[model samples]
Target: MDNRFEVAVSAGTMRSDSSAAVRFPHRWTPGGVTVEADFTGAHLLHLAAAGCVLNDIYREAESLGIDVSGVRVTAAGGFDTTTWQSTGIDYSVEVSSDASADKLAHLLEVVDQVAEIPQAIRAGASVRRASSC
Candidate 1:
């Protein structure tokens, strides 16, 4: 990892209904996927996670000199309305490459470290709202 490309993230808060856009110094590439989510509000968290992972994976693959011509990621997550919680998220990645199977497998392993959201969710991080009184 290049020290100059490194970034740190901190969480912030604003009143409900107030739009506080989170900014990243780096840009995320959509990789031409047509799938999109709409009108879900905070439910968009899952979509954000999926998109972030897919973007990170594609970026990492390119950095390693792998040609990604027709790559696709199918990510889906379910929220439990009863508990207002995420049930789980699943990611299916399709890469059109001539790389060996072992190399592709290694690429997937490297992507896990590059993408943070899915790992955090998988580790069961407690995401909750904390308001000051």
Candidate 2:
């Protein structure tokens, strides 16, 4: 079976309080952010990726002097039911900005490269519980 999950994270103008997802305070956007995802490991994994991309967009935009008004990131992936291992995660982005199309594109590219969570996922790590625990 495909244990797939999808999640979306939105900030600024893209934020929607209509869903049952939790809203968290954001440093970049005035209205904070909304995380639309269920409480599950698969959903949380996707949410981590999507939320990181959204945060990085705002951060890089400020560093580059891009006037971004909003950002939305949607991430999806599946786990192998047999091994309970991730199949990998994919994400998409939407941004509201007055910057030129090229600038926007470049900003996205930069964020894609620099988002810590995505990079960490790519690099891979060993996850294990403590012996004491």
Best TM-score among the predictions, by candidate number: 2
Inter-residue clash pairs, candidate 2: none
On residues 30-72, what C-alpha lDDT tens digit does candidate 1 reach at each position?
Answer: 2234334443643366555655655665678788877555445
Q: What is the lDDT of candidate 1?
A: 0.54
Evaluate all candidate structures by whole-model CA lDDT and list the values in order: 0.54, 0.90
lDDT of 2: 0.90
What pairs collide in candidate 1?
A: none
Tell me the tens digit of each residue's lDDT in model 2 across 1-133. Answer: 7777889999988887675968999998888899889899889888988988998998899999999998989999999988878999999999999999999999999998999999999999999887883
